[model samples]
Target: MNVSLTSEPLRPVVQTRPVPPALIEALSQRFGKQLSLAQVVREQHGRDESSFSVPPPDAVVFAESAQDVSDAVKLAAQYKVPVIPFGAGSSVEGHLLAVQGGISIDVGRMNQVLAIHAEDLTVTVQPGVTRKALNEAVKSTGLFFPIDPGADASIGGMCATRASGTNAVRYGTMRENVLALDVVTASGELIHTGTRAKKSSAGYDLTRLMVGSEGTLGILTEITLKLYPLPEAVMAATCSFASLAEAVNATIQIIQMGVPIARCELLDAVTVRMVNTHSKLSLPESALLLMEFHGSPAGVQEQVETVQAIAAEFGGDTFEWAHTPEERTRLWTARHNAYFAGVQSRPGCKVISTDACVPISRLADALLDSVLETQASGIPYFMVGHVGDGNFHMGYLIDPNSPEERATAEQLNHQLVRRALALGGTCTGEHGVGLHKKGFLLEETGVGAVAMMRAIKTALDPDNILNPGKIFEL
Candidate 1:
């Protein structure tokens, strides 16, 4: 009649609340064929480019309008079921995973360029629109959005991550580009923040708050982004260096001297080798810097000349120029695909990407130490960075099944993050503190700051249904 207890301590049980049958029925009737419970669809909505194991949502709702998003959130709130907003599915930090089981509200169907104000230098778009699409949409007007995060990431996704890319050094990240937003709050209420105006000293900075909230506080339906006029002249080039330290030092000098380089990227020797093989280029297998200058012909020439002198001071060679637009696209395409090239270089290996940003003055030391430490570990890794902005990525290739390899990569990442923090930098420059950097966020921001963040989350989403378990655990 009596049962004996095991000596081992019982693991804490995870309480999973199931979606209410009536709510599911209501959603099915409301969304009709737009709601999908298919396993394939749910699985696809569950994971992103991250190495995290797939945890599919209970259902997927393809929202085509802001009202659809509002209705879905209302239904989820009524049932107390998690609601995860999804865009292009291009995130690499496990931001899209349904860790606590939920319904994914797919906003990709809402893709549209609502309005473009060429004179005002602003564009309004649905959250589902991708960066490439927006650029093409605005190409005719001789203006473009500059927040290119490598991937053709959706505007909503990029805004949620506060993404920045190579051009960020000149045009800034989403935090600066986004002028206004239409957000669907956790309680299913729609609110507008900011306006088409260039600057506003209005009450609370809600626009900035929702820009990088990762859909926890609200779902972005529409975004108004700042645009820049297309430069009259553009030049792209690559310079080779004897060592990573030299390359980074050259970048530091360029920034220190106030050179207006549009894009400045760094690729370690290993990364260049991979890029050569995968991109079919003959780049030298050495530390390299890829740069782009945007301005009038004379201005571009001046900037290039100054950067060339700086590079020469650090033992850099003459730049290999991509003179034509096609050539420039080809070169930047290769740079953007560096992560894929690194993965392809190591057959059957998965990448564990690390992002760290340090002050410009300390970038050289931080990068040099990271390279040495990672190399000492004997792990296959590829390094690339938006050096102009003091942000970089190191993708460590490892067999996902090998715990030893994972541990080695983790150790390298930990050391690099600690070094960055010591240098008065952030653990992640552009990538949000998704599931991957939750612990690092705590370390970077003290307990009090994190507590304040949690308080904000609680105040906005009392039921904790929106993208649960992201940034931090409630």
Candidate 2:
């Protein structure tokens, strides 16, 4: 099980503060077997899917309950030591890096579905619950939670990153779906933000403030999420375009027409080839749009007809429909495996992924220009997008050992992000500004907004101990 992680030159220099002997003694004695100074366990908790590499945390604490998390934070706070919250370790933004070196509070064992208010269309769960687990737990209730974010990320991590994925085009992202959170603040005080009631004129909107804070503000102990009724009918189909521009245009028209498409993803020919090789299926090797519609039988048919017509106008060919749940699952599973496919496409290469979201109207301009630049660079890459909402990721596969390759990828990423910002879009759409994208945050939000963010960080986490060296630096 020893696999090498791809790393860039940006592997942060580990200038760690001393974990005082007294503090270590207190933690080891307080948690006993639950606490580990084991290097292997710390290594497992250290890195994430990001290509950026760094040293592991000094220690790891396996937290099983809300009280365990609160107590661990209290202990870490007493020593003024940095504490990083670890969930599924699925985030790709270096969200798990122990940049300043401390202890990692792992909550994966706290997996529990606390409550199911099916009638009220809400569910409460511990922070470690995964999206797939949540959907499975709620399946019998005729409801589903739709924010996917590709990986089977923990609900807490998903909320912290404000994640969205294939289904966000219809159901929205975590920011809209998350109702309430029971959070442990920087001072180790367990507080509740928001309520289960659908909408509220509540003070401060603290729930949302914590949602995308990237673990900078607090640790999420429990989360209450909004759920949606299962669509009466669901239909999925794939259509190939002569070129990416056509695919982009078709998506723009679909969104502009106000079609309630559940999922609309774009994959360039290069990506289709990788997916085909990985999934063991013969998908059309051209720019393609994978689309899904949800509604009544008649409504689904109408949408299908409309999108099909629009595709034909753009030289779409070989439109294929998935007639069974198994077929639809296969298609989406392949789609979700895109990152893995990209990595495997280039042996020993790591992905330096970019998250750029632009206005729907400007998607073609943003995406096509970036495509042209990447194609010119001759870097191995894959392009897939949740184009329904103008969000897409271009994964640059680069040789980790080649600093030049990494630099070229970063240059392309910078150009892509600047284009997105110019189009009135964001540097990061779903992936939070972890250590990787904090510089872009300043460029995107400007001096005043980032300063306000810093003020909030200072006010809430004056000790600067909660997941330090993430989002924005002090």
Candidate 3:
């Protein structure tokens, strides 16, 4: 397929309006000098990881408290301006993009560990607190938040995306971690959803409703999450495979055998090569499985034995164990660097990554076929995945400056998404359906589900003044 340069820039529908002097005055009265109008710029507000080019908001509101959030939302509602909740800015699907161009509600200033109930196994935190920051603060509490998206994203943003990572196989995703939330509705009402109880038969699960809403419904102020005791012992190991099929099969067997593996990531040969080139680490030019196990000493030893047996059945190479703390950290660090490594493979190429997940039984067949098709198409791509959860990412390196390559990359991405949905998998496993996956969402969830989602959005945001032109647009 030949590509043509799009004459128009990829931007949101633009609507021009004068900044409300009243809103600026109100912000000044409340936040003193903390809130600045100059922070809003075309590049600063609407920027995101997606290729969607957009202008920044008219103003940037720095909210340091729930009340501050309420005030900002109230002013936005009063002026009928769009309100975008910004956290961490790590979202790949254009979650942070201010499509309607109003106020960018930057929440990073509100980061704080509000309270910790080690006994209840729950912690209440301000929305701006990042996973790494929260964990660092709570390290001495003997309990920790388990969901790790590897991006050091804000707890609120992770919840907003319903994100999961390698550890998701055991700890589950944000869908299971979030217990409650403090949200400022579009009308600027402060509402508390859910409870601190272990379980509840509430009328509607509003807390869960807001989990992956992607800042379209309301602004997340505080999040209460379930926590777990730190594991007694953790071990990480990497095993090589001659083929991707063998590596996937080994992962499936281990999962089926009921061994509580902590994390299992799969990296195809192409991805391994990228990691080697970018990270300056020596990696064998073969498919690799980075696995970790968490449990008591005796339990971990037993798991190692079981996993070893399963690996042998699939022609897996000898498992390289990292028992020491530093060794385990180093092992995961290399895996986390896979994305950067992938982007670095091409000197001036940018990446367009797709996330898909299928049931464990079909994972190997789907991934093998999809990857083979991708490579046969002559697209330079890297494959990385949290294979334990049946989810994987394919990163296509493309020179956006080259119209031909961009067209090929987009076509390949669409094909991958189509194939994933056809295989009874989600178009996106962890990444939320931001602007990037809207088409896939329609295909995967069907028009009926899409209509229902639209209905919910309409009910919550009638004015469409919150991250407009994202997820669904008429």
Candidate 4:
């Protein structure tokens, strides 16, 4: 599984354009207390959870409504300044960085659940609403939003990244769940795409386009998403395996057999050990598979039996069930905290997290190769995977002041991405191409496709003021 390493040359940094003082003054006069020029506030708006160097925005605007967002965009367009949209700041791919030094429009104040169509299994909300909040709001209706990306990310941010999580194997990602959006274009005009209906023969499918555009096309102000009914019966369990391949193979077999697994996650021995220490649990420090089944009681039992047989064939140990709701929450919370646990495992070290996905059959090859290479790289790292969907992430711990460590991590990322592409997979699965994977986009999609994307950017934004220097540079 180990592969030779080759370093890819880093892209040269493009100089950021300066913001106009007149625009800042005008915004200051209009927004008054809502506008902040404080150094700490600008710094807060500049970065997300990524290890990328922070480049704080020139100013931060606390937007409270669609009008606020529209007005800010219009002003930025007038002054030809970059507009970086800020959400929960949970993005790990440098999506929220103010790379071009513009005004960041903070939408956290606009959080609101607009409407819930319980009968139709759909809900509309302002972009700032978090997934947890949305679920709490609709809990009384015997329904819930299933798209959980680990973080309590803002709906706007989740849509921007087209995020998915452990449950994506069954429930799907944001791309499939989001039905409509009210977007503020580069010119500050609000336009609606798609509708509340379940199906549509839309003209341009602009809704899909904007879903993962990474704020380059427009700023999402309102979102309409599909919801699911709470399962009648739910069960979660963890199984230990002698090796990583065995765990991954068991998952592959379960998936290929068409078992309706609600969630199928793989955590390597290193990750499991970190989670155990961080979460104060006694999970065996072996390659592990965490699974969830959802259906009628009979259906759930059937799935558990099928999965148990599959796991046994791969030498997996007995399943340890989380019988109660509180136990299930604790299990998932530990899984979601894998990144932070990895960070805490190494004091004073920052993490460079990256993800890739391939066909279900290629999951083992991709993950094994990555794990082997990382182990040989002499880097401190933790690995986790959503094996049913063939997506996984590795977080490399490094000292922030060490350029050599940063370069090594970047090289490891380049090798992993190239391997994924060779296996007919994407450079990114859920995490969108922000600043980190811009070069790899051209490699995954050909020049012609990338050129078409650039053309679309030009045609829509024209001025290149909306989230400038992201995805593919103009």
Candidate 5:
């Protein structure tokens, strides 16, 4: 944690490779209408929620099945053209950008609940199934998938980033829940990793390796994930704090004391104001911790009591309970839409959202200064955190035309990442090292460690054709 990182890099430069005319003709023949060389389709598949705007892919393949993905990838592999996997384009760190020109294989149509073993508490689903869709499919069976990254992102994208969200304090991320994967390697060879069993001492953890590879290694086609029984009792509450420090400190104590709270999210006063106007609710215009507890009624009550006392120690307001399903849904919906709320707060502003996470004990140290620095910089921003597990994000709303504003936001972000690394945390907790964080990845993992990763990528993808120019330069 003491080592200093090199200077963070700017936005990735586009490095488009040539797309063979014969390749396009072959794809047109193979996929017919499913293959699109149209500009709009290519643009739609090439972009995501990130601010970076690169040229669109040369073409897009609307892959509806695993075979379609394999075939498209096989053809691209032959030419060593980049093959970028496109799902629900919800990544904020430029994961979906087509920096190196190629064809985007959009798997949005590959959405189906393949199998459900409610008794075994597991479900197999297609790659393009959204988290909400997966939860809906199993809701009747009293089971749910808890990894909600706020954007209803595709399960395949979530697996690519190893995403976690509000409920991660308890249920964990895709890395923990995903039991197996059907993947198409760079060669377009379909291979299976892991199994549906609860535990496995498999020869190599290919499943884990692929989970957060950011598509530099392979593309996920189908995923089998662990599910949890619906909680018998669920209670939601919001407690306002005097400052961000108090809210974060209270969360630290709750986590340190071993509480099993399902969700603990923090939103700054600025964000609360934005949410108030956006969601049409009158929440206290102050720093707040939104919490949810799930268990038996008595158990939930005990957790509520414990967290309330801990919160009170930090001058938190009396808990505002959301006891009904409608009430809980509304509150969570607003929190999930916090990004949009922030964006709408400033018209014509683009967001550069930062993902920095530190150790539980260092949460206060890591966040308080960043908040002060960002506020002092005079940039419009909204802050939020999953502080129970030491992960937080700040969305800096910058005028895309103003290079000065963008540079200031970048500096603040660079400092924040440095602080997090110094405090025994990661450059990114959930957001993987995409085109934006390639420099930080090296800073956090070091030259030797990243060399190992590059070696693995080369071993799995000799031509660097799968999601090329992402994670790191080849």
Candidate 6:
């Protein structure tokens, strides 16, 4: 049962310094039949998602443990080879792009749950463990790690990007869930940041500093994550509106009312249409809102009633409920496949899915203005978002070869970032400041903060060997 991944394409061989035969021999001798320079290019090269920036690494090494990562870092440091940590390869931003090509440390082989302290409500896992795998492993214990971020992204990459998803409205992002991390620093020394003691008043929070660093500061090897008890009662509902503004306004009201939503997403008319066409669903060509509630049955019902009343005030239509697990899965599957559905709408064009998060009160205005701006530019886009968290993604379609369309899409993206920042929100909510959002980071975080970050980067990675030319272009 060989399941070939459709995302992996045969990219043209990009130019980079070739790994020396002597170095390859050294690696081969060290790993004993487990290392090869040729296999790295074929297997662990490019990303699994959209196209963005530069090429893949010169070589790849499959890391099996923390020591393996440290050893690889030590070798890369000695040889002046750039090391880009590879997890599930699911980053939309080009965080894994080997701009200054060297060795890509593939951490997928290190997939393991080292410990599950159910009583403590924290689980320790290697960098390679996927979120879905982690959740499944802990399901029987009535606990789950809820920072979703759409894809089955690796725990390490999720931490790198500081990801948040559908459940972030309730459970929070990786910034809050990650308790500790075992990282191999730029100097090839292993260090642990944070503790599993629920709270810490320690000096300088290095744990959070690495959370959204996007593999620039260090290579994550192990993570300790807080878990939540599986909800005793859950309900999923979908509501539609004639206009997206109506749906968004209703969401704003729901949040203002403190309805305690577990998940709330907005789907614009274009997105609904795309999903209907690609996923073969009979959804109306109107804006839609999907909401989920989790708690005691009585508490969930009370919250749902409040949300329903708010929706009615804002022209929201009849709510439909998914009563079964299969139905709920099918509902969320359409949401998860938004990027695929949107890209499929335009032939020969891949998606440039960018995210921006604005304040809850300003979400409707920012999104509506963005829609108008995009429409005025005649660019095709699909809008989907975690409305409760005020974080939305605009999936723009552009021909891979057309510079005109790429420029147009980029302009729209920049405008979205500016609007999000002006509205007192972040340019990127989940996706870190990889190559794509570096300019926006400058605009949002300002010169002083960015300089401090760059100084930290320099202090940690003086040689600039780890993920060179990413985030801040020092």
Candidate lDDT (C-alpha), each: 0.90, 0.91, 0.82, 0.90, 0.92, 0.84
Candidate 2 lDDT, tens digit per residue, 1-474?
Answer: 122222323555456666888878888888899999988899999999898888899899899988888988988888888899999999888998999988899989889999999999999999999999999999999999999988899999999999999999999999999999999988889999999999999689999999999899999999999999999999999999989999999999999999999999999999999999999879999999999999999999999999988888889996899999999999999999999999989999988889999999999989999999999999999999999999999999999999999889988888888888888888888998887787678777878999999999999999899999888778
Q: For residues 1-474, could you state the per-residue lDDT of candidate 1 as single tens digits?
A: 122211211111134558888888989999999999999999999878777775588899999999999999999999899999999998988788887787999999899999999999999999999999999999999998988897889999999999999899999999999999999999999999999998999899999999889888999999999999999999999999998989999999999999999999999999999999999999999999999999999999999999998899999998899989999999999999998899899899878788999899999878989989999999999999999999999899989889889878877887788888888888899988777777678778877999999999999999999988888788
Q: With candidate 6 superimposed using the best TM-score fit, by how many Å does residue 392's alpha carbon deviate from the native?
A: 0.7
Superior candidate under TM-score, 1 versus 3: 1
Please identify model 4 stretches exceeding 4 Å from their true place.
Answer: 1-14
Clash counts per candidate, in order, are 0, 0, 1, 0, 0, 0
Best by TM-score: 5
TM-scores vs. true structure, each candidate: 0.96, 0.97, 0.94, 0.97, 0.99, 0.94
Which residue pairs in model 4 clash with each other?
none
Q: Over the stretch 1-474, how does candidate 3's per-residue lDDT look in tens digits?
A: 122221222334555445577877876787776666675443575676666566677777778889988988887788777888888888887888866677788899999999999889999999999998998888898988878886788998998899998789999999998989999998899899999998899799999889998888888999999999999988888899899999999999988888899999999998888888876767677999998888899998899999999999999989887879987877677787887787677877777778999888878876888798889878789998888888999888888787787777777777776667666888789988887777666667767988998899899888777777677784
RMSD of each: 5.7, 4.5, 3.4, 2.0, 0.8, 6.1
Residue 190 accuracy (lDDT) in model 4? 97
**Which candidate, 2 or 5, has the higher lDDT?**
5
- Lowest lDDT sum, 10 consecutive residues, model 2, at 1-10
Write model 4 residue lDDT over 1-474, tens digit each, in one string.
Answer: 233234434433555778889999989887889999999999989877777775799999999999999999999899889998999999988898877788899999889999999999999999899999999999999999999897889999999999999899999999999999999999999999999999899688999999999999999999999999999999999999999999998888998999989999999999999999999989999999999999999999999999999999999999999999999999999999998899899998988877899898988888898999999999999999988899999899988888898898988898888888888888899989888788788878888999999999999999898888889877
lDDT of 3 at 140: 96
Local error of candidate 2 at residue 184 (angstroms): 0.6
Q: Which scores greater on TM-score, model 1 or model 6? A: 1
**TM match of model 2 to true structure:** 0.97
Task: Give lDDT: candidate 6, residue 230.
Answer: 90
Q: State which candidate has the highest lDDT.
A: 5
TM-score computed on alpha carbons, candidate 1: 0.96
Task: After the best TM-score superposition of candidate 6, give how far the Cα of residue 30 lies from its true spot, in angstroms.
Answer: 1.9
Better model by TM-score: candidate 3 vs candidate 4 = 4
